[model samples]
Target: MDNQKKQPKPWYKVWWFWILVIIIVLVLGGMMNDSSSSSSSSDRKPKAHKVSPFKRTYKVGQVVNYKGYKFKVNRVKYFSGNSMDTPKSGNQYVICNVTIKNDSHEKQDYNEMDFQLSANGNTTDFGEILTSGNYENNTLDSGSLDKGATVSGNLIGQAKKDAKLKLEYQPSFLDDKTINVNLN
Candidate 1:
């Protein structure tokens, strides 16, 4: 036999083996982290934000300001088949004359759905009734208000007879402060 002894392979010669080992370790570590985070997240509670603007209630025929926009509910009238676009039998239509002014410098988009009519603790949405020659002027249909501009229209909703009604006006769905107009 020769005097020379056979030496083991160098670390660089097995570089592919070491690379596979490192990849496996990293994959296992990522999987473990994902599972731990998911489990802990289920045990945590969501944080609540403080409401800042829900401190006051407004009345009808008064200018209510919210987030720099001004709103006013002038008058509320009930019509029972009196007009050509009145509600169906056993139902009545409410016409709320309203005016909205954009006092801020920026243009704000207004949605008619934001105005809800609450009667006897139940809320009803504004409805578009068939009126003579488009008698119902819906200002919110224009979409946006310019700076220092005013718009006036009638908000129509269906309700029952002699129901205690109130108009809820909020600048946006995300806003907490709502102006309630007693229309009874």
Candidate 2:
């Protein structure tokens, strides 16, 4: 044996081996992080969004086919201030009854945001009327419709007493064929 102890293996001599080990460790670490990240997402509640699968090309009385659902504006009614438990001065309520029938194979969800109201060509959202206590209980409920099921509800909004009003029905945000129902 040499008087000097055998020199330790040079790092470069095992460079390829170390590189392979490092690559494996990094790959496994990334995989572990991926699983942890996905789990974290599930720990929080996801935000909700509305989606429409088609355009609005149907008239008020015509059956509007959208994303495997059929919608028809049955009728529109106007209510004066004194007619409700709460009265509003110089303003009236325009309520449109829409009949929605899901024609798809699965259930479909709907909410007040799906319907928009226009007064004298000015657009209004469901939240605007909802904030007012006058039309609180009369508004439609957001719910899911089973396949071939039908649900009818009122979409209520406030408008000027003499305003020319219309209800715009959008089945999804991506749709362009928004059906306009004249409430004049």
Candidate 3:
């Protein structure tokens, strides 16, 4: 037998395996990014984002179809804010915070939300869409968002006598359509 105790298989011996792993990792990473990028998104404002899914609330199986986006209504809260019908443009939005969580597995790069109100079978009042304008921690992930994590912003228009309402959502994934929800 050779004087040299047969050295255990060295790392270099598995060089091919490492290369294969690296290739697989790269391919997987690329695939994930491509898939996410291809997803349809809204035209809302955008900001720097980090990959972290938060949980909120939504109605079960309640899917709202907007321009083309299918948003699931997680939670609904009513607030009396500035009416979008007002003559003024700025400061008209009293900032009615609507807590929403995305149920679609697809990412929603939400920027602003539009709330519309109509009463007694009147015209649909799609409220003026408002953006949070704050991204320190306003990111809704795909699927159910964890409790406590929320994306809050101002919603134009006030509710008068429990009028019919529709909420619009803009995702932060891709540019495509808005997610509209009918809140009656």
Candidate 4:
């Protein structure tokens, strides 16, 4: 039997190794696995940012700005995108249900909903018109929401890897507001 037989373990077994591993994972992950930069374009959901944009906690009478319009959220629900049942390659979306009250009070029938996405506030040339909607409200009482009426639509914005994204809503016969969204 020879005296020089086994070698010692690599540093990875110790706390220092864990530290190095964590550092490497963070740096490399941030670069590759970043929300906007991941090569896997097929993936529908990205790793969420540290803070969510929806975390603002909207309440009644609180104005929510989408695409370009500011509307009051008398009720909140999952608004289905109403996507075609046919499966398309690498196309995925989520719909947050919303029941909006027409606080404007002018007896408005919202005909069309258009979106304008911006990267770093370049509204002229940025994202696409994610959705063009034909939304109609029978009639909203001024300052009173149609409690059970459902306003359905999807937040349709393209996935841009590793960039700042903004969503704006432009309603044909409604309101408008520039939505602020941050991506990795």
Candidate 5:
């Protein structure tokens, strides 16, 4: 046999070289796809979150309509309890003159207990002290309202003296929606 040397194969023709080229092509294609997708997303405006329609606040004297019933807070008054009944120390009575109109075709039940007073981080519900005060005649009572009928009365609760208060009315026990009236 003659003494002959064989030449090595070129880098592009090697098996490992072709495998590395395929990997690089795949990585570059993935990078390009990611960049294009990000650019497209950045071109569109962001979506806005929706707000609930049932959640709302109203000022005094504004009519709040809920489930075909119309409610209006005519006035707010503060008082010191009478001799027969007195509030706790550093507390006073908050009274709201509210009018409710049944505009629906059917009769609706209403109660003074539906109203609440929130002040100084405390919530006050209708209590016995409210009925014993000098304003007893003005207090609201539980009754059924017929269509086209209107009933106006006072809702009372005890709160801190001179504290800013919010009168809240919840029409139904099962519903979380409330109508808030600010009493400054």
Candidate 6:
């Protein structure tokens, strides 16, 4: 009997090997095609952004409805502090008596910081001066409000005594929309 060893089949000639090679080639080709298409599309100009409509400005004593909340500036009072609690030179305490109501179905947050006082080209944030007499113990507090709950208090700021003022409300940082209340 001849003792010649049988030659092993070449890897390229194996059926399973060819099948795997074909699958790899197909996958690579598909990936290259997808990358080329995406690169071409990236050269196109982006779509224009839609502009938002203008909102109406609310006057003092008018209820402003925004983002499921109701805001009203009842009145604005000026105070020339007594000898013990006077404002800075050429400035006086400007107090805004306001009411906020949560009209949404869920709880909402209320903060004095949400209100800003703008006057004479300057903007002032909500704050309290211990010397300013606490505005009659009715300063607006920061807290969470339940649905339909209401809170009323004073937002105090220091500004020129004769400057026309406006109150701005922007409770959410994610939202750029602001409600302006003219407090001349």
Best by TM-score: 6
Overall local distance difference test of candidate 4: 0.39
With candidate 4 superimposed using the best TM-score fit, by how many Å does residue 156's alpha carbon deviate from the native? 1.3
Prediction 5 global C-alpha lDDT? 0.82
Write the residue-wise lDDT of candidate 4 on 6-81 in tens digits.
8877776778889988999999888776765555663767665643224453443355643223454233222234
Off by over 4 Å in 6: 1-54, 130-136
**Model 1: per-residue lDDT, tens digit, 42-139?**
66965576343345555678787777788888888777765567576677878787888899889987777889898887888876564554345453
Comparing 1 and 4 on lDDT, the stronger one: 1
What local lDDT does model 2 show for residue 64? 70
Q: Write the residue-wise lDDT of candidate 3 on 46-157 in tens digits.
A: 5566422222222324644332333354444443333333423222222333445444455444434233333334433334443433321333323334333335433444
Task: State the weakest 10-residue window (summed lDDT) of model 4.
Answer: 135-144
Give lDDT: candidate 6, residue 53.
Answer: 22
Model with the higher lDDT, candidate 1 or 6: 6
- Candidates 2 and 6 compared: the better one by TM-score is 6
Q: After superposition, how far is residue 182 of candidate 1 from its true place, in Å?
A: 0.7
- lDDT by residue (1-184, candidate 5, tens digit) is 9788788999889999999999999999999999998888877856576443257777889888877788888998888777876888998777888999999999998998888888965777865445564577877888999998999988878888878788888878898777777887
Rank by TM-score, highest first.
Answer: 6, 5, 1, 2, 4, 3
Name the weakest run of 10 consecutive residues (lDDT summed) in model 1. 133-142
lDDT of 4 at 34: 72
In angstroms, how far off is 95's CA in candidate 4? 6.2
Better of 3 and 6 by lDDT: 6
Q: Which stretches of candidate 1 lie over 4 Å from their true place?
A: 1-53, 82-89, 137-142, 175-177
Candidate 2 local distance difference test against the native? 0.74
Model 2 misses residue 163 by how many Å? Answer: 1.8
What is the number of backbone collisions in each predicted candidate, taken in the order shown?
A: 0, 4, 18, 20, 0, 0
* lDDT (Cα atoms) of all candidates against the true structure: 0.76, 0.74, 0.44, 0.39, 0.82, 0.84
